[model samples]
Target: MTKIIKSGSGKELADARGRLAPFLRDTLVGLNYAYYEPPGAQMLHNNAIFVRSHDYSEALSTEGEQPWKTPRLVSSGGTHLAGSLADLPYALAWVEQDFIVPESVQSLIWEDLVPSLLTGAVLPRWWRVTGNELHAVTLYQRAGEELLTASAKDEKLRQMVIDILSDRMLPQRSGRLEKALRAGRLDQVFPQIMPADTFYLASEFRRRFPNDAEHWGPAGKELDDLCHRFASEVSPERLSQDFGVPHPALAHSYSRELLNVKPFPTFQDYSSRLLAESWDSNNLYWARLTDEMGYPPVMLNRLVPQLTRRMVEKLFATNLDDWPAILRAMQETGEEFRLGKTASLPKSEATPGP
Candidate 1:
């Protein structure tokens, strides 16, 4: 039996305190749960219930900058909070299935479709813009994921999605990997060190030593090709190929198999699955950054714009006579600013708010 749970302004929230009481009472009784509603605005006293939650502390807010942007449930025993947007029903379904929860509930929440409207509350402009390559990489990966999920029906389309996703995702780790390579960690730790400086070092090495190519053979050549391709584009198949593994049949299976958890199954089933999952992961990362790193959203936001401006300024400052070289450097710097580490500015310079 599909249990229909309807939530909205008219049916979910009412002006009469007495009349509004029973619906909450009934919802809790029907689901074997308890309910809570935050205080309404005093001025209009319009009975605008800002938030609602189950007895277990599963919360849903209708107020604040990013109201519906936050989780509906902060799992009591878990570190992660479960949030959903109406735009990404497939993601909600994936979560429900992965968690072994009732898909009915997932459908119900989505049918209510409160999150889509909440975008007005938590606008994209609220996402603080900056030149952080990591953020750019993340955005690219997200956009790629969306593209992939939406293209999943076709094999060629899936491959294309995987290619773009993998490519953008790779450069995100370049700063750290490059640093490690420079520090000679790869030579000491990795079984065989490639002559190249970064993640695709093996490819560079293979390129330089075609005679030794027989040693690595088809597998090595494939890996080298995969890595080189990643420098330009990426996808689940490419990611799997790079890891010398097969792509997973199941969607969103990151743990049981690394290759399986490509976020979107075929790269065409966008239906909100990837976005919801990605947003959950991103929110958790952001939450940790706030809790552990002491970097609040406001502070993080202020830092990015300034850092981007500074990076742009520095590109112009370098005294270079060659016009083409200068232009190339500027373009590279801009790309770096768009997709690199220098996106985060010092905390001291972070603005509080407008």
Candidate 2:
């Protein structure tokens, strides 16, 4: 029987480690682990043992000293573990205990476009994000092809991102919008790409709290409050049915544009076309692409996630650009590491969201 990894199989991880460890040593942990490299190799072996703890809000936790003897152990608290006293930066890996810790770590690693990433692992989001500035003078460019019609972008996949920030629940192209994102002068290089409303809201959010230097408070929390009200007033089905533009705040307005799909699309036809769009833009044309595809918007936003990711990945393959360096601006401390540039993104993993 084939052992599944993402769903978190302790046996499969143990078995793979046993089978692959001899020649590679713990390098097999790279198959399913999160490793970190601090400044000047601050931590031993420069790899972190990331476990999915119930209360690890410190997102980047600093575990002081670890027992290298414990190859893979699950604590009573449910956090998974994988580390070693390899004596060198010989291994940087981790595996899931009860949760898919390795998977999450891998996701972040792949998002960056360093030379070490597998030959094709660097993505447009990593490149375009610099121009768009997803925030912090850095971009998290997770986009599909330029050929991707606006409507072809999958809003369902986009909306799946958790609002960890709590405010501005909508994801914006990181612009040097507010004073806090980076030096105010960065605006000379990165033109503002966030929607005008989004920019205004983000600015308003930052203006309220002068003391929070990073603008980590997420502004006035208008997006959160609006979402809270939306939750109270609207049923999820109605929301998904009515406003399917990926983000909730844009849903109501977005639905209006979809309502006007030229020639009007039947439900099945609309659904099929929606599954094809790979990148999203707030522009009205994207919402109307199904109409252009002969699949008008008479139906609602009924996207299928599994099919969407596959289609988007195909789109991602066609047009790839190399990422630019941003070493001068950001001071990203702790747990910073990159995989081999020739290393490929792990296949067979399901990313339901883009």
Candidate 3:
């Protein structure tokens, strides 16, 4: 197993720095090492390397006639170097010259920090608006590039970033996120995405990667509101391909509901059989049995919507002829109702109506 190096902010950074100090200082000084740390989020809070910089101090200086945005740094070390810098290229040039500080050995900033910092996710501890619009644009570009790079490399990380980007709805979402989505790395996240974002992320995934149904198809299966939407949204071919005939939830729910009746043992047997078979035959057998129960048309008319509303509408609208049994059942129900009404009327009224 690759060792999980604690490399980010807080005690993790301190611990890592302490463990590899002199070697780290040597590495940083000569720039002669080929060290590539694992790709993960780095903590910039309490970053020792950036806190001692002149730009960082100026950004934090309360006495200065500058526009620093809060929350202000109260503790000893907490500032993002890439974000805090007034100008990155110029600032890095200066930082290289000033790298002879004592903290270089103590802090031992990782080379991986370069790529991780480029992710641009770490907000500055404090920043001043210096009328240079390029500062903000540069930060965005740097962050976007790293996010895209990181996302392309790891599928789960890509999904996490996609979830974050799903906040604004697609097209309206950040171009960085859009680029991430287009990278086409879709996988289920551990602990799953939050309930609110699941459907949105699933939706965006489907809209963007229509052919990659397997990725987004089974998402939001646990949510009641999204169940019908999931079924209706995907194309029939993709639905069949990805979800194995609509979805197991819809099938299992239908079987559970339909088979729950008197003649308890038979109900159980039928349910088990349908569930076990999990084929179109099960749907057909149930449809026939429901029709035989003296309400074929109304049964499907009601039950289809319960399974999925829009799908049923599309089926009935476009493929009515395909379900002759349902049509016959509906006609028979209407005829039965009319005849029963006539039979219940008084003889004089019946004769007059005749």
Q: Give per-model TM-scores.
A: 0.20, 0.18, 0.16
Worst lDDT run of 10 residues, candidate 2, spans 328-337
Q: The CA-based lDDT of model 1 is what? A: 0.29
lDDT by residue (1-354, candidate 2, tens digit) is 244445548887787767765536335544323232211222222334332221222222446544453244345444434444331111221221111122112222122121111111111112111111122111011111110112123332212211212232223322223221333243342333222123322333334433433222232233334334554332223322322232112231212111211111113422322321111222211122222222223211221111121222222211122001111101010001011111221221222112
By TM-score, the better pick of 1 and 2 is: 1
- Model 1: per-residue Cα lDDT over 279-344, one tens digit each: 112221222222223344454334332332232233331221211222232334334433444534
TM-score result, candidate 2: 0.18
- Best of the candidates, TM-score: 1
lDDT of 3 by residue, 1-354 (tens): 014263365667667768777665544532311121111212212243433331334443645535333112233344434123222322232233222222112332222222212111111111221211212112222233344345666676577555654553334334544453555433422112221233233334434554543322111222223334454433323222211222122233211111111110113323422222222212222222233333323333233212221111122212311222222233333334335432322112222110
Model 3 regions lying over 4 Å from their true place? 1-84, 87-121, 124-205, 208-218, 222-354
Q: After superposition, how far is residue 117 of candidate 3 from its true place, in Å?
A: 4.0
Off by over 4 Å in 1: 1-260, 263-270, 278-280, 292-354
What is the overall TM-score of model 1 with all chains considered together? Answer: 0.20
Sort by TM-score, top down from the best: 1, 2, 3
